[model samples]
Target: MRAAVLTGFGAPLSVRSVPEPRADGGEVVVEVLATCVLPYTGEVFGGRRDYPLEPPVVPGPGGVGRVVRVGPDATRLRVGDLVWCDPTVRSRDDALTPDIMLQGLSSRGEGGARLARHLPDGAFAEFMRVPTENVHPLPPEALDDPARWSCLVVYAIPYGGLLAAGLEAGETVLVSGSTGNLGSAAVAMALAMGAGRVIAPGRDRAALDLLADRFGRRVRPVELTGDEETDRDAMSAAARGPIDVVIDLLPPAAPSSVTRTAAMTVREFGRVVLMGGVGMLGGADLALPYPWLMRNSVTVRGRWSCPRTANVGLIRLIASGTLDLSPDRIRTFPLDAVNDAIAYAAAHGGPFDRTVLTPRAG
Candidate 1:
């Protein structure tokens, strides 16, 4: 099989022929149809702390493909079924264990490594393998519109964050980095989940306009002009009386102003869910003022959407059409063009709503 092989950190992935993966016991081999590129992939390949996996490793978090073969004990899925595999792979024991997930973090079980080896050799490859548990049946409609399911890969994080924050219908929520992929998803999901209003703050007016067109009056746009007083006034106006929750999806190295704006905008006693920046690529240096958090009685939370349980709900939401994701948000490339795709995403200032790699030409 031809795959995008990462030879080293900070190096371009090359198209190379690799052995076709077989369905091992308790696993299934998937004929790769589509896999999405994550913004974090570059940071991971660049040897960032958020991605601990050594390079020469395949990069991907979510994909949808057809099952060609299945291992014994993999009863939930069968050959010829189309499914979306959960990006996070974990063992039964680890799932039961306190806090370990597959691929992105260290774990005691072989499941993570094995599943990592299974996924399309690289997310940019022709075929892949995964544990049966990793596969979720995709609606035929979703297969016709791959972008809908592909964006699910990126949206899952915000979904989990909103759920964890215990968001309720009719409550107002503020999202930082509203133009990025996760930020856009947060805005969409908050509206779909019935928030009274979704305030999205960002520096990119074009992206904000796109979101506003999709969401209409439900989406409020804020532009950060790099002026402290302006940002504070914007936050004050956006927050008004109070916000029920604040979803911070800023990059790891997001400008300090953004973090300060987020800290200032959230309502007192409201939850601030940090899902995007703390661990991964760029937003690591962002700091929160401890005194402000204490004074406001704000609850700070961190989330990484790697649990199977989380994926299950996300799949159901897609099936139900509540997600309302579209393919126009995605830009597709062949496995051989992985490097080009990564460079494009970086240059575009992405957290793309969806970017996919296909093993074969459509």
Candidate 2:
């Protein structure tokens, strides 16, 4: 089998021949059909070395594929079943005694140890080994249109954030970075969840127009020119009253300023959710003033997708057709072109709703 190997930090991933993985107790071997490139992959490779990963690692976090074999105790999944995996392989120490629910960002030593157990030789090759607990049987509906499942994989973070913020139907929700993958998913989900109005703040007019066409009157586009007063007025006018929830997906930038604006424009007890900023290559520092938050009784929460429960719900939504995930919104690339795919997604300023990598040509 051949896989993309990250030979060094800041080096291009190379496709090379490698041995195939084998199933072990409570584990299964999967033949890779497709996987998605996450924005954080570049950051992981660029020396954020905080997570448990070393060079020569296979760079992937989430993917969907078919089971080729199953080990003893892996009763939930059978050979030939299509599934989506919780690609973050954790160590017994990390999983058993988690100081933090750090998903895929384990330190180098920790990751190496975890990989030794969870990932067999050539796990990134054509056949990847995974514990049955890490695999979810793809519902029959999803198998018919695999691209739609991309929304489920990427939307977990925002879904968790919105749930944490205690979002309710008929409330106005504001989303920054509205044209990106997660942001677009947020917009669509907010609408599906019965949000009265979804305010999308960003500068991508063409993309916003497309979003508007898909989401109709549910999505309201706002320009982000750093014009504080203008933005405040626009938000206030669109929301009519204080906004119910403000979900910020932009890179670290003026959190204090944005929170203050949100506090004023949102209802007295409304919440603001911060779901972005991880893997930010470069961005300005955002200050969240404690005094202001305490005074206004505003809830400022940081959300990272950790628990797999939310992922299950996201998958159900996709399977039921409640979330719209059209193929035009997704960009597919072959595994050999992973680097090119990453570069294209980054440079294009994605409204790419979802991007997937496949073992074979699409």
Candidate 3:
């Protein structure tokens, strides 16, 4: 099997032959069809992000593939089944608070790192070994173009945050940092889930215009001025109706003030779900006014990733034609060009532009 191996941080990923993964207990081996090359993949690979990824690992988060083998515990899954490989691998021992690890990417902590040791490789190769529960069967139609379906990995994150925020149909929702990849996906997912109006706020004016053009009147794009108070007012005014829910998907480079600005726009008793990288790299902690929360009865929650079942719901949306994955939105690279794929993804990480690696040859 051919794979791109990360021998060390700051070192180039070497494309070479490696042993194909075998199905172990409670695991499934899938032939990699299409896997995403995230914008920050270069950062993690170059030691800039300092993610807890051990050396000599195949690094891809999640992807769309076909099952080739399954463990004895699997009853429903079978060979040749098209499936979405979920990267969120949780420790099965603890149901209440499972230690999480993004298989083939990074671990949460020591506990997650331990879990990664068991399944260290990701979907960057011809075949990947995934936990049985992490594999979700897709509709037969997905076979037409697996590369487009790979966007599911991006949409799943925002879908999870929206679910955490308790988003309801026909309610107004605001997606902060909506010009970026995941944030833009949140805007699309919100509309698909029946949000009456989506307020998209971002610093990129051209990107904001693109969102408005793509979604029409249902989407309101506001160019953020970097002024917290002003941005907050802009979002509130764009909503037309009271903002019922606010989902913050700002990246690490964004200031805490930006998240606070969008969150404060939600109406009283509204919910806010935080699923961004804002304080992860190191900066001032996000501070929401205590008085405002107490008086307004606001509900705020932090979400790491979507629930395990999010993939099922997301696939339903795709199957139902609510969420469209137009092929024009993605750029596909062959498995041998994994390094080139990483570069392309980083350069084109804007909203609606996706870069994916097709591991299997045509």
Could you say which candidate leads in TM-score?
Answer: 3
In candidate 1, the residue pairs with backbone N, CA or C atoms under 3 Å apart (3 or more residues apart, or in different chains) clash, namely: 118-129, 120-128, 251-283, 252-282, 252-283, 252-284, 253-282, 253-283, 253-284
Give a tens-digit lDDT track for model 1, residues 6-108.
7777777878888888888877777778877776667667766444454566666657788888998886776878788766665455435533344422222
lDDT of 2 by residue, 1-362 (tens): 78888787778878888777677787887787776666655666566534445556665665677889999887567788988876544455556643322223333354455464345232234567676777888887666655446445567767887888888989899886677767777888787667888887766788788778887787787766666677778877866666889887764333445534544556667798877763344443455557666777888777766466666777777777776566346677777777887676555446644566777433
User: Could you tell me which 10 consecutive residues in candidate 3 have the lowest summed lDDT?
Assistant: 321-330
Runs in model 1 with CA error above 4 Å? Answer: 48-50, 95-122, 227-229, 278-296, 349-353
Q: What is the full ranking by TM-score, best candidate first? A: 3, 1, 2
Query: Which residue pairs show collisions in model 3?
Result: none
In model 1, state the lDDT of residue 76.
73
Please rank every candidate by lDDT, starting with the best.
3, 1, 2
Superposition error at 274 for model 1 (Å): 0.8
Per-residue C-alpha lDDT of model 3 across residues 213-238, encoded as one tens digit per residue: 89999999998898888888888888
* lDDT against true structure, model 2: 0.67
Judge candidate 3 at residue 53 and give its lDDT: 95
Lowest summed lDDT across 10 adjacent residues in model 2 is found at 99-108
